[model samples]
Target chain A: MSVFIIRRLLQSVLVLVVMSMLVFAGVYAVGNPIDILISPDATQADRDATIRAMGLDRPMWLQYAYFVKNALAADLGKSFAFNVPAIELILERMPATLELASCAMLMAVVIGLPLGLYAGLKPKSFAGKTIMTLSIFGFSLPTFWIGLMLIMIFAVFLGVLPSNGRGATALLLGIPVSFLTWDGLRHLALPAFTLALLNIALIIRLVRSGTQEALLMDYVKFARAKGLSDARIIGVHVLKNIMIPIVTVIALQFGSVIAFAVVTETIFAWPGMGKLLIDSINVLDRPVIVAYLLIIVTLFIFINLLVDIAYSLLDPRVRLGESDS
Target chain B: MSQQPALSTATPVLQVSGLETHFAARNGIVKPVNGVSFSVSRGKIMGLVGESGSGKSMTGYSIMGLIDAPGKVVGGSILLDGREVRGLDAESLRALRGNRIAMIFQDPMMTLNPVLRIDTQMVEAIQAHEDVGRHAALDRCRAALAQVGIASPDQRLKSYPHQFSGGMRQRVAIAIAILLKPDVIIADEPTTALDVTIQGQILAEMQKLCRESGTALIWITHDLSVIAGLADQVCVMYAGRIVERGSVDDVLDSTAHPYTLGLLNSVPSRNPRGQRLRQIPGMTPSLLNLAPGCPFRERCAHATRECLEDPLLEPVLGHPTDAASAAHQVSCHHPLQTGIST
Candidate 1:
């Protein structure tokens, strides 16, 4: 197990190196951000000084090397827009996105698991069909559109909740959380639920199919033959077996949830990494773009690593066999 | 046959009469187990022999009440200890299962949950039916595993299902079935997947366990040799119905039904070397829309006009049909008087 963890950690480092190269090159491939950063009336001398200061005059390879070395030292350079360290700015905004993403994830799992189980177990039942039908809207409807619809209904028409922003946050573990207060919960509900809708739907579909297949497995039939009650059989026997895939999907989706939060963040004007990303992109901030993407890529890789670890823990065959079964 | 203690005095451990199970398909309802009836006395093994799709496994499922959606026991009575088990509520049925009766599937992997350790699964199997502490249940699990001839049960209990070899996995499954010393055990081709040597060992061990513990067993398999070697009584199924049943010696030496003869002839072991092995002619009739006739009529060599009509399970040989010698009943219009009537 220790060997597996060590091997995965090594793989994650390699993945980050390769990914950093792609992000560095990809960011540079876009037009220079200096055009937007400087005034149109600026003199050539002024532009040259800005270029020299920003190391734009340096060869692309050398600049990339500098970026990698700085990233390795936990210094992602200064953002062209904010004029502050990119890493520091990202760290500042990380908590809000993390809190929101985690909450959305919590909501997805809390609601989706039982719903999926019931639908899968009784796909032909009335409630099962109804849940499945409703879940389609969660999948097909646009997240921003859903966010707008929810705000219009609860915030605009009913006035039951605030229309936008993270409201009334209290510092918990140095992370400002909105869900601590009822008013904050009301404000957090709309966008968080909107972001969660797609995840919940996707998770529901994944779990439903997985559960349906697992329920048909010979082991389940054997469990039934052994006389385990419906509760124990479904809970202990079926649930654990099917959780392996669901956990993998959910973990991988976490990165996407943060990335996809762009539209939701903009629509709700929530102060998060998504909003920060948009602000950086508008001014063509090179350092911020690279750092944001690198962070997301790192997050994605780490999540995948955790999933591999969870896989081995969940199914012994995965740990024992060469192929991940 | 010789070793079985006089078991007739006690009520048979399992009894199924008119067991009919239907599976709903797109085309029509498939009658997999139609009017199937059999009983296994304490300390006896009844071999349910059939080809693929013969409803042998379905019969086992019906007795265990394991039939689920798309398939149901429409009309039947599964009697465990002389109590009608067909209409028992799920809770009561669950109480009877893994306690009064248990099942071993064709795949050991099927019987053992992959995520759970053997000890966890076995202990839970016991605890599911009875209120017992973990250590006490573990002791019973080890005892059961040892009884099934597994070595170092203590260490094996900690291992997961994947840790064990195919044969060893099957032994663990067999151990689970005998965990509670269930009055009856329905093993659906438990040894079908194992090699001959492992199969032989398991068969011998199982026969001995039945003798020692007085557990009635229904061993379902398509292999005739397995039946001949392990079972005291044999029921040969063609298509959702038993065509022949008798004592092991009587049935193997001189079977009454033509399908049974066909089954015996098709075995490669019975054929001479360098010659193509005999196979029964024609396919099994589709149960969904079977013609109004015997299920085996399409494949029977001696099929006559009388065979076009459904043949009641009757005594065609010296053994009276459904009589005390249920061991010798043959549901055939024309029984083999002198030899396999081909």
Candidate 2:
């Protein structure tokens, strides 16, 4: 198992290296931040001085080498716009996105699992059909549109929830998390729900289909024949088998949620890394963009590795280093 | 033939009469187990022999009350030790299953859950019906595994199903079935997927287990050789009904039903060494929209106008009325004469 983890870590390093080069090159291709960083009234002497100070005069490869060197030293360069370390800027907004993403994922699993199981168990029942139909709407509706509708209903008309921004937050483990406070949770509701809507639909479909297939497996029939109670059979036998696929999908989706919540963050004006990313992009903040992409890549690699380990854990047939049969 | 007085006098452990399991389809209701009847005495191994889709497995499922929706035991009286188990509520049926009766399925690979440890699966089977503590249940599971010829039961119990080979997996399933020492066990082709050597070993073990524990066993398979060696009584099923039933010797030696004769003739060992093996003519007829007649009429070489009429299960004529032959019955309008060789 340790060997498997070590191999995965090596692969992850390779992926990180490739991603860093791609991100650095991709951000470099974008128009220079110098245009936006300096004013039109600035003299050429001041501009040259600013460019030299920022090491903008270096060749592209040399700049990338410098970036890699600083990255290895745990310095991802300073944001051209914020003048703070890019990693620090991202980390400052990390808690909000992490909390929101986690809440959305938790909501999706808690709400979707039983409903999907029910739908699979009784595909012909009226309630099952209704839940499945509603899931379709969840999938088809755009995230931004859903966010707007939620705001309009609960915030605009009902006036119960705050329409925008993270409400009062308390420091927990030195990280400001909104969910710990009721007022902050109220502020979190609309955006989180909107974020979870698509994932809930995906989870429901995945679990429902998986459950349906699992119900037909011979082991399930054998379980039934063994005189096991319906609860034990469904809860342990059926649920464990279906969970293999669900775990992989949910983990990948969780990673995507944290990284690509830009639209939802923009709509709700939530102070998150996604929001920071958008603000940085508008000004061609190369350091923040490159850092953000590299971080997201790392997150995906980490999630995929975790998923492989979890997959092996869930299914006994999936050993660590056995060649594929 | 001298009758075994003990077999005739003892009360049967399980009796089913007029069993009918039907499935609803878009075309019409398909009768998979149509009016089947059989009884198994304690310590007896009854072989239910049939080709694929012969409703042999369905009969076993119906007895366990494991029939799913779209197919149900619509009519039947399943007397388990004199109590009618048919039409009982789910909870009541569940209580009897894996406790008083258990089942082993074909494809040992599929019978056990891939994700579960053998110990978890076995212990749960005991705890599901009984209030036994986990330690006691684990002890019982270990004993059961050892009884089924598995070595190092302690190590085998901890391993998951995938870690075991196919034969070993089937042994685990058998161990679980006998864990509760149920009154009856319905094994639906349990050894069908195994190699011949493994199949023979399991068959011998099952027969010995039955003899030792007085557990009535229903061994379902299409292999006549297996039935001849393992089962004391045999029931030949075709298209959802038992076409022939008798003592193993009487059924195999003086086969009455022409269909049974066809099955025996199709065996390569029974046929001439150089010639091509004989196969029963035609596919099994669809249960749906079946005409009111013998289901095998279309395939029987001896079929005539008389076979178009439904035939009742009746004793083969000219056979003595002794207790041994009395138990032998055939459901064919034109049963082949006695003393006919395959």
Candidate 1 chain B, run of 10 with poorest lDDT: B1-10
DockQ values for all predictions? 0.76, 0.88
Model 2 stretches with alpha carbons more than 4 Å out: A322-325, B1-9
The single-chain TM-score for chain B of candidate 2 is 0.96
After superposition, candidate 1 runs with Cα above 4 Å error: A41-45, A320-325, B1-10, B317-327, B339-342
Indicate the residue-level lDDT of B18 in model 1: 90
True contacts kept of each: 0.78, 0.85
Write one digit per residue (lDDT tens) for candidate 2, span A26-77.
Answer: 8889888899999989999999999998999999999999999999999999
Tens digits of lDDT, candidate 2, B307-328:
8899999887778778878888
Error of model 2, residue A287, in angstroms: 0.7
Worst 10 residues of 1 chain A by lDDT: A316-325
Give the per-residue lDDT digits (tens) of candidate 1, residues B235-327.
Answer: 888789988887787687778888888888898978888999899988887889667678887777788999888888875556445554545
Candidate 1 lDDT over residue span A1-325, tens digit each: 7766677678788988998899888888888888898898999999999999999999899999998888878999998877899989998988888878888999999999999999999999999899899999999999889988988999889998887888898889877888898878887888889889998998888878988999889899888877788999899999999999899889977889987699998888889999999888888898998899989988898888788878888988786225432
